[model samples]
Target chain A: MRSVFRVVENHRESDWTHTIFFDREIESTPGQFMMVWLPRLGEKPFTLSYLNAVTVKKAGAFTEKLAALEPGDEIGLRGPLGQGYPPLKRPALIGGGVGIAELRLLALASEEPSFVLGGRTADEILFYEEFRELGPVHVATEDGALGHKGLVTELLPVEADSYAVCGPERMMAACLPKLPAERTYFAVERYMKCAVGLCGQCTCSGWRVCTDGPIFPASTVAQMDDFGKRRRSKSGRWEAV
Target chain B: MIPLPRIDPPLINASGILSYPEVFTAFESAGACLGGYVTKSVGPREKPGNENPVVVYPPEGAVLNSLALPTQSAEDWERDLEEIKLKNAKLIVSVYGGDAGEFAGVTRRMSRFGDAIEVNLGCPNKEPGEQTIMESIGQNPALSAEVIERVRDETDKPVIAKLSPNSDYLAVAESCMNAGADALGCGNTLGPGLAVDIRSRAAILAGTTGGISGPALKPINLRMTYEAYARFRCPIVAYGGIETWEDAVEYILAGAGVLGIGTAFMRKSTHEAAALTRDIWEGIQEYLDGEPMSALIGAAHRAAEGGDSHA
Candidate 1:
């Protein structure tokens, strides 16, 4: 069922994060999303920040409609709709900028998940303490503002087990060569519409970005069309085949 | 003398027939004269259905499926319903479940969109637990009544029970009406209908036996629709083998208030039902220009009073 629901409530700019509550309860694997379109507003896909409390940055068109929404505002949503990250017992998580939302829940869901979160400057980091309370957290900002003076990838621990990572593709590229075979890396792709998998809109390489995966293993997406060391445009739109 | 009735919104379709409404809106000329969006059946829980290789193509005209109702959980179906654009379109839900409780729950949740909640009392290739659920409730009227009654407790929506022709059709249909069902969706596919490769002797579908649909089942569907109409007054939605408006209208004359079109949605990028819908709307408009829709209701009564040839 490609469940579409109305926005029951939306919180604009809550600590610089927009929290939206939908009447549709989305039970999903951590990395899944719904292809949300607001008619004339254009369509964009978002990661599951917190199914219980969905949050988005007031960044673009999709978020703007979401930001302008009042209680009972109607929004076209199709999902809880894609494959989410596989459950991990113990894992290390890595993310940067707004991409951290993709890895946050996984950090919260794991038995004990360690995380490395980074942003442009220390002040721009999204959820620092949020990750710290969930597990041990390491931080790195590009300007040497907070914990480390380099990119967040510089702070990623050399882990030999399970890991769920979301950040700039450059960061993912730097870490891919360092990853062990047993380790799992769940990455997010943005251009998903018809999250039900019927829409070839989000097809990446041989698989569908929407239904088959929004979160795929580094090994699986290694040679695949879109995923590697480079970030799928944060705008994450699909390219014409 | 037997009595007969006329059907309206004369076609039924699979639950999730096309991905979005664009396909239906795109080709509005394919005999989709009906006024309702007959949704692919949905449940209260998210069902992943069977894995891929779930659908297969055997021949140019022949096809097989084992799409074990690949769906989001049932709760999610309701979310989809919220944004649905029915605008003057009747909404019908074709639902299936492994047990009476599951069926009841799925139906009850969707009863908010009245019109009808087609209770699938007979889905042939369900897994063990679900197969047992359908057989147990469908074969026995008392059990069937209990299942229908359970759904009635939730909403006053018209309950359209989809009966499997393989079981005792007339009996199950009567039980559904007795339990407050307003209509019947006659004859889902037959007997874990089997198909195998002659050379390999192996089953054609991943699920071994699958529901036989398309042209292969038309004659049987027509026969069953006639039989159920002959015995019961509950409205009927005839499903199977309906490729043309003429085929659909034939079911209407026989006595299906609505009809379900499956299999064919896979055939055309354009829905044949769109053509059927135009024909139906035009016929109604032309008739209303000369007489009132109320006059059509009167005609139905006259047709019923005239000895029935429909059955």
Candidate 2:
């Protein structure tokens, strides 16, 4: 299922982040991800910002190369993989940093999506203008440089029909009590090797993130002891989150 | 021959492929279509295995992995197994070791959790010294038998020797049988094969090389299964590149009593994996017509000897 796609656009959002759109599109759902490959550099999982686009941040050597791609550069891609967000009505989307990439599609699909975007400063808040076009947008920055001075959790909307949260695990954990478990969904990440679910590399609490979910309801997240606390390293050893 | 644990469908998940005890619910979801569930290779000590890019798919309809057996300790697995629920399926625990002593220690600790114990004598990725463990023991008849004999001393449950495909497997198979192995897992993955991403000029797998599975290993491992079964006339669990029902039929014709499928599971969901077993079983029944299906074991070999084709 791996195919090469030409980079149609490499939109540099910041010094550390870039959004790359491809020449082709696939039927992908929100919360699902793609394993993006750059020759010799290796493959890594990235949440799709759109069916045809992935927003990446240069966090390591591999992603550093991903940041170097220009228009017409080819990258290997496999998926719209793993389970994605289930349909929701009047969903309130919560995102932190670049993790907002996972929530963009969900926001676009909803008729009246409410977004609470947060980061350390205004510069780190992603997709603010894009989401404002879709629905009401709330902003929070730890530095008090945006709409709200405190955490995004402080700006939670109580009237939404459902909540779709994707961000740091601890932030998602904090949102659990303010939102209903049955109506809240979290798009989590892990060190995934085989996105097809064979390698057991992305297992958390007994659930294969690549198969059972990358998106899980808050109730399911409650049962996972390892959530926000521990994750497996590349060698399969459990390490502190 | 002492009857082994009944694997109702004769199709089981191969060791190291979605076989972690912590996720035994995966096996439950795959359902009654599976005759058995094999655990990842447990060892005396917890192993972290190789680094990332552990698995890769080449365009050749195959998979290469150098996971190097990242296993939890035997103690952790015993604790994990107690919490799992596998309805109506047998459990075949796969265990590996650094040496014969380590193998015995792990088998003694984990054997009680399994209906049968599969000694993983052939893992090509865990290279601790001059040779990988598979090359050290799996390729040597005496070393393979010694490990099996020590494992035999540890448990009363059926012991299966999972040998390597990269060596004189039939000779190793014969030795394992004599060492009191109850059944033969008629070959592990073949060749520490290499796949390179031509543009980067770097190996695709982080380990640089890994065991070859999927379609490429089918013919080679099938021939090994056929020969090993013919020589020992014992139960054989065939592994390597079984994707469709026809492949299952070919292995059964080659004298496999049980089939261990890993690569095919890569392309299927848990729900789809369950359906695959039933599909293959239905295909076998249709191909067998009205004749008893068990009568077809080693039918190809019999045909070669100029005897009744269905004998």
Candidate 3:
């Protein structure tokens, strides 16, 4: 159920990212997401970055309103829903752009997981210091302003027994060739309405991302024909992503 | 007291929403207080529905969807139904087909899995040819009766005809009841409305036109229920844009024996549906304190006929 929560803390994480902590505690796993309701603006899903916090990147209309939220502002929150990535040994966590927010809780939960963080430029990189505290950190920026100067997938370690990746589908697809499909898990993003699985808006090749997974095994991802090919818009029309 | 296959609370999840088995179990566990759950429309074959954006929420409390009735085959749905564990909720499997034979075949196979079967004769997103099938079968009493009779021939399970509000639903309701349908799922989504994106200069939905639902659809569907109730004796399972306690009470007052909620659940979290259901029940209790449940059911019809002394 949705409960209105007052923002306890609103800290700017970076130039484009902000972290909002709720006064109420929420039980959530690393890869699970919560639907944030901004009264008149509409609802959008965001990955849980901390126990009671969601990190937002000012990317669109909903996120902009979320970013502008101040301490004491009220917003409705529903879930920590969906199947989260299972625990793994010898894990490697990779994230791209704001996708790093999705990996934050996972990294903290892992036993010394290797991290590969990527963004368009150095300014876009998020949670670098926090992630660095949890594991060995590798940074990649397309503009060559940070660690490896290409895609974050380029920096993913080749030897991790199990891997957790969350990012743009293209970025995850790029890493598929190098990783063992059985040992890798990827978190997918989709246009969703009822995060509990009613609205089939997030279905990818018959898989309802909201219920079947927002996080899926790489083997499952490999079988999804629409994985990186297309995504549905808010109006329910498919568009090449 | 809906006439066929008794269900308490008298509310069920509508078709096209909450198709997943886990979702059904979750809603029940979360205390949505539903009498039953209707699976998304299942057909003879696995249908990979229309291209995306399949759903849109207009500024009003309404939603437009062009999902094109995506469903796994009846065999697949039957198998999936086996895995679901509904605590106390009844299962009403909704089946759709391209033709009467297909509908009967699917209903025959799926009937064993649910307490009742809901025949979907009104999906607005069907292609022109398929639309003709739904329109012909739903609007033409003779054709609708034939289809219902064919389905009735397949199973002893209660058969509910889910009709289209876009046509003469009152006639369709009468035909369904006459043809052996035990009940009627009062309506499906209302329109093949277009939602255009001015910036893109294109229709927002992949199918171009989609079924209109949500709060905006309540009045249209309620009227359909009132009319159907006034003309027919079969139980009316009313659905369309019910989001509040008042909306639920309105449906009951309009002669609906059961309530079907879909878009309303979409507007809130699953757990919230339980709260809403409680509020609706409480509202009904408050109203019932003043009148009998029988008096509330078909009150509008009775008042219109100048037979309701309360009116």
Candidate 4:
């Protein structure tokens, strides 16, 4: 059942991060995403930062419009789409930049996980307080304004048996060598339309990221040669990300 | 009655668009109102496909893609098809092979799971060989007929030939009709076009060339459907840039028995697609009033001939 829901709450998390809470009750799990539509404005997929809520960053044309949206505004939403992060008993949740939005909910849902959140600057770090409530939080900012001053992967405990990781492809790629391929579950992001596996735009290797993953086993990620180095733009051209 | 199958709405999700089994229920619930869903083209073996930038959308509501027909083997697709349940919608499994024997082999194995078998004769990005199979088979009447005849021998279920607009599609359609094809899926995508980013001075897609689809391809597809209808007796499944109710009506008027929606589905949500279907149905009803649905099927051709040509 898809429907148009009114914005109940919109919060500015940082200079660029904004969270919008919808009136709609959509059942979803961590690592899944929603196709947010603003009618004539257009539609794009956003990872769920929390249940029925999307944390957006002002990046492109659609996100710029999404940033300006306020309470009482109506936006069309469909999903809780794609594969989600599975529940893990003891896991490490690692996120980088806006990719942290995909991990926030998973951190809360997990039993007691170590959260490694990374950003370029302290101001860009997201959901720190919320993640802190669930488990120990490790923060890393490139500027050294936050906890550990380096890549979040630097803060990731090398000893964790299993992991849930999300972030820019490079960040995930950096973490890949550290985590056991059989134990890590990576939530990948890609350029998508339909977000339903039909468009073929979000394909990584033979896998449709929209369906086969947004969440992929470490073994699957290990198989994709283009995982960290290349990504397709809206124009469908592959360029170095 | 659209002739190919017993679907009420006469609209279908185009091949290679949305083939995920878990999402079909959402599309149906969202009002996609499709009569059938065509799976992506499956072949004899697994193809990893081309690298990044497989699909791109131009400003004209058109999408260019050089996906290189990436697919799992027919055996894998057959297994996948078993899990997909679309309630009332028919499953039209699309298959592709480098040669007629492979086509027959794949069709024979996949036919039991589908309401129909659609032979993909339109992919534009086949690697350059002594002869590219799609062009060699699709453009030549004898070769096209032979391919269809082989597939026809494999299945009693309806056989649909998905023809390419790049070739002499009308001849292909005519040959397919004569070769025992029950229907024709007209106009795959248009042009093996290239897009280069001026900033990087590099090709947009990893493949460097892809088929152009969307509204920009609609005019070409519409004309192809019109010609196929005028030339052949088989049902025509028209696709290209069908995005609106008016677009749907235009295809029907131009002689498309079943309409395929692709790029438009990319732009609109499932709810919007459903609404569009309802609106098109109502619009068709209003346009027909008490006239039989058949009256509008080839009305343009009848008008062009100044009489009922079929009669």
Best by TM-score: 2
Cα miss at A188, model 4 (Å)? 7.5
CAPRI class of candidate 4: incorrect
Please write out the lDDT profile of model 3 over residues A29-141, one tens digit for every residue.
67878888765456678888888889899988888889988888888777777878898876888888888888878877878788878899987778777777777788889
Prediction-by-prediction clash tally = 41, 0, 8, 4
Off by over 4 Å in 3: A1-197, A200-241, B1-3, B127-133, B290-292, B307-311
Error of 3 at B292 (Å): 5.5
Error of 3 at A103 (Å): 4.9
How do the candidates rank by TM-score, highest first? 2, 3, 4, 1
Q: Please, what is the TM-score per model?
A: 0.51, 0.88, 0.65, 0.63
Q: What is the lDDT for A220 in model 3?
A: 81
Q: What stretches of model 4 exceed 4 Å from their correct place?
A: A1-241, B1-3, B127-133, B307-311
lDDT of every model, 2 decimals: 0.60, 0.82, 0.78, 0.76
Worst lDDT 10-window in candidate 2 chain A: A230-239
Q: At residue A147, give the lDDT of candidate 2.
A: 90
DockQ by candidate, in order: 0.02, 0.44, 0.10, 0.08
Name the runs in model 1 displaced over 4 angstroms: A1-241, B1-10, B19-33, B56-62, B128-133, B198-201, B270-311
Candidate 1 Cα deviation (angstroms), residue A153: 22
Clashing pairs in 2: none
Per-residue error (Å), model 3, residue B162: 1.3
What's the residue-level lDDT of B147 in candidate 4?
A: 87
